[model samples]
Target: MDAYKLMTIAAIGFFVFALDKNQKKFPAPIILIAAGMFLAVFPYFSSMELTKEFIFHWILPALLFTSAYQFPQDQLKRKAAIIVTLGTVCIAITAVMLGFALYAAGQLLVGVSLAGAMLISSLLIPTDPVTVVSILTQGNDKHHLAETIEGESLLNDGTSVVIFSLFSGYYFGSQSLHIGTFILDFFYTALGGAIVGLLISWFVAKGIHKITFHVYQVWLTILLAYGSFYIGEALGVSGVIATVVSGLLLAKELTNKEEEEEKELRRDLKNFWGIMEPFLLSIVFVFIGIESIDFIQMDGLLFVIIGFLLSVIVRGIVLLATIKSVKPWRKSYTNGDITLVTWGGIKGTMSLALLLSITGQSGGSDDGLLSWAFMMIMLSLIVQSLTFYPLKEKLGD
Candidate 1:
């Protein structure tokens, strides 16, 4: 697609339709997906390909940094326990349960392997609430829930990526995964990434404090976002986790300096990143739809549907079990509220992004794992998002 044509379409689809309050119930990805699928029939729109390198190197870092910094530091501190458990423990357990479940169901699912099933399970661990956070923060009480919803994703995104990375190597025949080695490696990678991000971002913060020019300050943040990620990856640590940590620590540093100039700097940074994230994600989602036609196989829809069901059941069961340990979740939520949380955990961009990445690394795409993953994501987004409003209304705050 032509750049102008794509931008025009994204603007109309997003700003005009997606940003409308009435359409808040629907995710912007659905709109872009429809538009991309509609445009896919034409040859012009068919040529725009989304490469894994572009997404991981550019888009992922920016989104992680932007979201992390914007996340309130105080809320992160207040809800640390709940957030940590949900992100790490909840995701880990769900991934294990779902992975094993998928592997067991592989008799019906043609050519599916235990490794592929495990990768798919891990990839789906991250959730994207696009505009649902706005709906979640209707009042002061719900505001806490909103923060928790978004906050958990920030950390779990790293956990998800780490799990995917470990299993990806094993799936692709690049490296073998030993359980003992994997457990130790995961901790070292995650913890090392955090330390790297904190160290780099601390220096970046000092630089920001010294610099008076908002333009340079903004550019420095951009560097931090991408820099921390690339640097962490170079050191064989988790880049995703590094970027998240960099954003959080730097954001806390920036937020502490409440001077008028610093405030202006913050505004400028927000303005730049706020527009960039949606626009880039719009392009990525549209590309997902364009790419979808190739991956769609009618014969496998039943199996995919079965897989989706398994995913939901496993995630819900794991969440209900894991969340009881967190006092906030126990105190603030009933069974209905927990149902809403499970429903709201609709796999979105991160899931699809991770899914699409398979073709780039794995030779076979795990024998139609992409197709299975693509459909599973679509079902999750469409069913969960559309039903979310009804659930919200029924459950009440």
Candidate 2:
């Protein structure tokens, strides 16, 4: 048995659940990350590693599924236009600009293609909802701002997955990739995943109608969540998107029902996930803390710093350009809200997990890039997270 898993559970039991039950004063992510970092000093943890296969295949699907299912559909529908634009279009723009910037810099990137560099940086683009939302709830979160944040993260993370998958295929796969091929692939991957997810969700919904037992319902949904992802992957599409789409639609279906039994089932589903999400999240963040140290060092510090700056700066600029120029966003959102949204784009577990999974595929050769991504993520968490509350206070709802 791996002691890392045991250690993570202990840390969650003691630090997360016991001490920070409210998580108002000290958030779980920060606490778990600190625990992981503290534990990393031991000799045994120095060589600890989590494979990309485990992360992508096992952990990724569950985390993606839970977040998607729990996300409120009303908020997504209301903010559909802005959220979709920010999540997809802005993300694509930021990725391209950042990729070009890195390519132009010509430092820290060694023989890596534009797609490869974009793949590394795109992971940083999707802000962590759990980290931001937890902090927001501690303050005056209004205008469904917290939901907006969560929705943005959920949508953008899905977009990030598409971007990562597309780039990964083009950069690594044996094919003569060109602009036309890339554009076509970008659509195919995303649309393909959506179709797969919806079909599975429709079938699952039909099954859910006939099921009476709560336990059986939960079991079936579990299958749907993990199953959608596996099926999408097997079908040569995007599993990440599939899991998200299925979970989102199915969750909405459960929540939208007016019947008492449906409501009770929703409660049961919520209770199950209420326990499961945190357990999984704690392990991921703690593991990030332990594994991140190996990726950070003295030489790549400049590149990491630059990468972090570019990520933050580019995101802010893109948001400003996108929101201010657009008529609907300009009227709906104030400059202050934009500021909050921009600054609140705090990177957490999602970024690190995606990066780890990406780095895991390359083995030992891209340690420099891996270290750069890790360091940049640390900067986002430390600099952005610690300042998030005070920033929120200053920019009142």
Candidate 3:
């Protein structure tokens, strides 16, 4: 099928799913994903193809920006301690643990080179904000808890992307990284994206302040989000960070403006993103399911299972080490929250994007590994997305 036509069908399918008021009973993402898989199995859909550019340029920025903008900045500030610790420190711990585990496991089980396995491990570690945050925040009325989860998801994505890029560079790309250079390397990438996002957000807000029309102003933000991401990426900075920072900054600035015109624009933008959020999320998972149809193979099943186990073990260790500081980490949240959060770290689009970005040496070693990576990611998303809420309810005692 032609790409345009297939996308039209996807849009129709998503609309049907999105219109369901009982969306809480069934995740729109998982449903659309299942639809895509069903379509893929049909012989008539043999021509479908998933484009990497479509994901990076279109789907990712929209999803990230919407997630970031919808995040409650004030709530995030209120939970600053938990957010900062988990976002920065805990995320780094999880990444390192997972990378080393993959290195050791690959050598023992797959005979893969240590560096290559580490690269793949880095790619797999970052939890997709789209999947994880959506599940965690669905119906929970605890604003502080919700903010902590959302804020952690927002900031950790950038950290994970930066680390993933660094390892990818060291192992597969030309840029060499030594242990001593790790601090400087991380700072440059992350700080570069943050700075770019902040500046652009300020400029865009100022520009929109002059525009009294609400529709155009909202559209301007959409442009700015994509623009900041692409520009930051062009500078070899973290585009994900740039996109997210730009969103948070815009959300903060717009939330505070007292003027009637500004308030109206903010409302319009909020409503617009609210509609787009589920729509885009559904489309993303659909793309994943359709792509999986082409990539999933039986021979790689064992490796996929191993990768999933590695993901869980590393996350478990990180949570155990980091859960000490959360005020109500134990008391307010049950043993279930701790376990669910640890196991609920679902890898999705960001991981796939990292893998897709691999080219030449950065990618050569992972040729046979891509199928396994893709399968593990699909499994992560399905297992966690489906189980997170039920587990939360079952374990909330």
Candidate 4:
């Protein structure tokens, strides 16, 4: 697409977002997605494809960085155990359980392969940090819950990607899982990404400290955010984790700056990103909406519905079990907390991106997988986003 057309689409998305904000009755993402779907049928947008590379490389990194940058470091530390366990361990468990369940159902109904089902399961395991954090932090006073959710969302992407890659290889008959090898690969990817991110951010921070120009500092910070991701990917590590780690490290450094000029630079950078967050999200959600039109008429809607229902059940059961096992340290959580967390596991851009990746590799022959993934995501966003706030209020009271 041409520059003018790209700008036009972005402008339309922003306009929808503005309208949604003004009404304050529904979430902006839902509105943007609906508008994208409405506009996608037109000739002008029919050719505008939402590619996996475009989303995974160009859009996701920035969104992940922005969300992680703003996350409260102290709160994250306080709830580290909960966040890590939910993000990594619970996600793994859910993926395995959901994978087998879907595989059995597919065999009995539509005959999807075990590997294909597992691949789909892995892709949908990670909750979208962008959507969850956006909803959880909006006019909600439950800081601990919000922080736990945000932190988990940020970290879970890496876990999901690692799992997805393993299953993808298995699907292609390129790789097989050995427990020790899998553990080693997971740590190497995740930890290596974190190390790369920290080192890059440290160097960038040092450079910023010496630079006097506020404009240059702001621009450099943006570069560093993307730079960290690219560097991690170049090293064959988890770029998503790298971006998150870099953003968090940089955010910590900027927040701790006592120098007046550095503080001014930090303020300018934050102001710039504040506008960027919504702009990027509008484009992403709209793209999801547009891409979803193709899958709407997919075969085996019943299979997708069954998978969606199973996902919720599995998530709830896992949360209940995990919460019971790992006692909270800072505060006690009630049944309502478990309910909110279970519902708040809303899937968004990341899930779609992973699905697109699989479809691209498999020549799009995996019957009903794409449709199932899309419907599950839509169900999560519509049901969870609408009810989370009210549920939180009721549970709190």
Q: Report the C-alpha lDDT of model 4 over 1-397, residue by residue, as the tens digit.
A: 5576578668976787676653224677777788778878887876678888888888888888888888887887777888888888888888889889889888887788898788778876888644445555665465666787788889899899999888888888999856666678889999999999999999998998788888888888789889988899999999989999999998899888788876787679778888888887787887777787887755777787787777878888888888887565324666777787787788888888887786656676664667777787787777767766667667773
Q: Show model 2 residue runs off by greater than 4 Å.
A: 1-4, 7-14, 22-25, 105-116, 141-143, 168-177, 358-363
- Whole-model lDDT values for every prediction: 0.80, 0.76, 0.74, 0.79
Among these predictions, the greatest lDDT belongs to 1
lDDT of 3 at 319: 76
Superposition error at 77 for model 1 (Å): 0.7
- Provide backbone clash counts, one per model: 0, 0, 1, 0
Candidate 3 minimal-lDDT segment of 10 residues: 358-367
Q: After superposition, how far is residue 25 of candidate 2 from its true place, in Å?
A: 5.5
Clashing pairs in 3: 172-362
lDDT of 2 by residue, 128-246 (tens): 86766776666554446677677777778767776665666665675554667656776787789889999999999989989999999999988998899899989988787899899
Check candidate 4 and list the clashing pairs. Answer: none
RMSD of 2: 2.6
TM-score of model number 3: 0.90
lDDT of 2 at 245: 93
User: lDDT tens digits, residues 1-397, model 3?
Assistant: 3767467556755685658544444656677778778777776664666566777888788878988888887776776777777777777777777777776777776776666776777777777655445555655543344466667777887887777767777776567767556677678888999999999999998898888777888889889889999999999888888999999889898888888877777778889998877766666677677777766888757767887888888887777667755566655655556676676677877787776666334335456677777787888878777776677667662
The alpha-carbon root-mean-square deviation between model 3 and the true structure, to one decimal in Å, is 2.7
Model 2 poorest ten-residue lDDT run? 103-112
lDDT of 4 at 197: 91
